[model samples]
Target: MRCLLPLLLLLVAASVAKAADFAARFDDLVRTATPRQLYALLYDLPKGGDLHNHAGGSDRPEWMFEILTDPARNGGDAFYTRARFGPETEPAARYRLIRRRTYEQLAPAARAGYVPLADLSPAERIAWANAFRLDAPGEGRDEFFNVIWPRRGDLSQNLDARLELLVVNLQAFAAEGLAYLETQFGLDGLVTPDGRALTPAEAAPLIERRLAQPDVVATGVVVRFQDTVIRFRPDAEARLSEIYAFVAAHRDRWVGINMAGIESDPRGRPLRFLSTLRRLRAQHPTLSLSFHAGEMDGADSHVRDTLLLGASRLGHAVNLIKDPDTLLLLQQQQRVLVEINLISNRLLGYVPDLTQHPFPEYLRTGVPVCLNTDDRGMWDSNLTDEYFTAVTTYRLSWPEVVQLGRNSLARAFVQPEVKAKLLAAYETRIAAFEQKYGAGSPTISDALGKVEKVKPVTYGYAKRTWGLEFR
Candidate 1:
């Protein structure tokens, strides 16, 4: 027994030594590589999943333009935007963007103020596209929360466009080496081409049919969904009940329920739905709950209240650090995960400076945490940017990067067998990555050559933040 114990100890020591070697190599790469090369390396790195994504909010404006302009893909839907506001424009109709269906129903004078999306001049098109994202200086949460969603207008009613966007997102994530995606894909406001509201049951089959297509299957991205409820609405409780039941009925593809909306609103407080959630949990015990908690500007017990409502995951737990008891609970239990959205928080002014973010604290202190692109399109960024931000800002070690990826999958609301497969794949891929980049491997320049061939798609955020331009 003593002889076996010595051998086991030797193995453990060797493993630790190898991990330390890889960490040193990763630090060297970060120190020596240019911003572009480092970005490419992280872009090529294997990632587990995106668990806090909003399907609609993740659609890039370029993708939206392509889908909207293509008649065949968009189900012949026409879109319009207000090019000029006049006295005839109603207070609500003064939004910058609108759909053709909504434009048609507007007063003639108000309709005259709008132009077809395709008819916009080049400059107008650029301006229109820019409106969907936080591209300009001084743009923050008010612009994002007040205008961006409303600008989506009636596009949310088009199931075809939404499904196509999903496939596009899958392809994009697949290219970035992500293997799983758990997006919040709500079908609450879907309407038929002729303007009839469809039930979630009716809309779900369309989504199922679209996902079954060969194009979607080719991406090799395992996709699951969470039905979302806008918690600030007056009817949010009823909506949550309906969504919970819908999610329970659609466990095949739908795995959980998420409450989203501005967290600072008193109406959307975490405890508001406690009784409803408890009643729902009594009958539907298996459904997972991941709520938007601790996203406020000030300290509060929303994180604790969200836990009280039986949430196993918390989105944007920015203020979580303020609640010492809850933070300690999370650290000791290590059961629930905090979905950290660095770009979203920064863009929304929740954390103006990421260096002050509590993510590093949460991670180093044994709290389970994972990086996510909460709304990539709005930020004009991707998963790679999130990793790049963490590595550069926090100086993450090799094992820390691997653990972040693992945490995302481990805490995902996916089936056990699927999660197991994903975890195994991630382990294998990350091991290969370490071996390829660690000491005594290829030259850094040669490694960069291989990385440059990846051709990661960059946007305003990458260009503005990192001066990275990808062709």
Candidate 2:
């Protein structure tokens, strides 16, 4: 018994040592590296698609501020101001879409101290726009998603504006190395102008008119289901039917539907969403079906119930982690993809940070997880930024990032052939990138000044799934 206790102690100590080694390595990489070096390790990497999106925040915040303040455009927001919270910590301040400054300084101004999810203040908004301090961890996720709830419905509708907004956002994402996106659009179904519902045909004109723009279409737009908020209306089902039928007709533009919003709508049921999806799938089996599942720590019943709702993609899906059997069923089924947003989760207070996140367990167990930025504007993030948070914080290597990228492409709403083609292109990029710039993660160690691994050499990344040796 005494010998066994020493053996156990040694094992535990060794485990702790390994963890400390990884953390020290991470700190070295972050601290000693320049943004440019960090960007290279980050730049031109072909991310598959952004499965999770909030139309308002998915793009750059300056774009939103630009629209709000542009003399050429029109929205109802008023003048900006600030309340004195602290010298360095003014929770309120005026922000403007000033064109003269560097592109990073733009932000929107407003009346009162509206502390929305991202801290609705000029200073905070400006900081977020610049990607300054954007990588820090910890906050409330339920509030993160729901806090912006008041604005999403109002901000999403302007097709022309959003189309323009998305083009700029796409260019920015591309600059950071993303090539594809399963970008969600059109949540206007919840509110209709003049109280007249958007008939399927009307929705087509609403969308096609925007997609007609070359810049808009160049971004690779995929419409998530379009619906107005129906939590209060009598015609929730009818409206959904309209949206589904519209997708059936224009399957190419409208890719899928996600039942976003707080769970537990008396109407937010699998039968309703499934009935709509099942009907839509009959015509467009190719159409994707994703949902914001028990982002809530909802009732156990809600988690399982949402899974059965026939969703192809599950965004957030934090609570579902609580039900292991259901998690297994999802893994076995394989069609379901999770939009795991580490920053979003921490910001929304799901877990303290990536260290506490369930991603390692979920990914190791075979449940397909796709990293995403749920609300870029609010979270003050981009898809690649979210990817970075996943890596160093979670201790994922170059190989896993490759797997994550492939997982995203596979789980994307695009056709199978498109995914194949995209992966092929990535192979070409990796080959060229490898010859010029080294392929490994740069980690400094106690024994060595700087060590970098050539990813292709070490982790056999392929056009599809990661190399078997890794598993």
lDDT of 2: 0.55
Q: Model 2: per-residue lDDT, tens digit, 336-385?
A: 77888776666666665458677877787788987887777666556656
Q: Which stretches of model 1 miss by more than 4 angstroms? A: 1-19, 86-96, 439-446
The Cα error of candidate 2 at residue 429, in Å, is: 2.4
Model 2 worst lDDT run, 10 consecutive residues:
456-465
Q: What is the C-alpha RMSD of each candidate to the true structure, in Å?
A: 2.8, 13.0
lDDT (Cα, 0-100) at 390 in candidate 1? 98
lDDT of each: 0.88, 0.55
Give each model's clash number. 0, 12
Cα lDDT tens digits, model 1, 303-350, are 999999999999999999999999999999999999999999999999
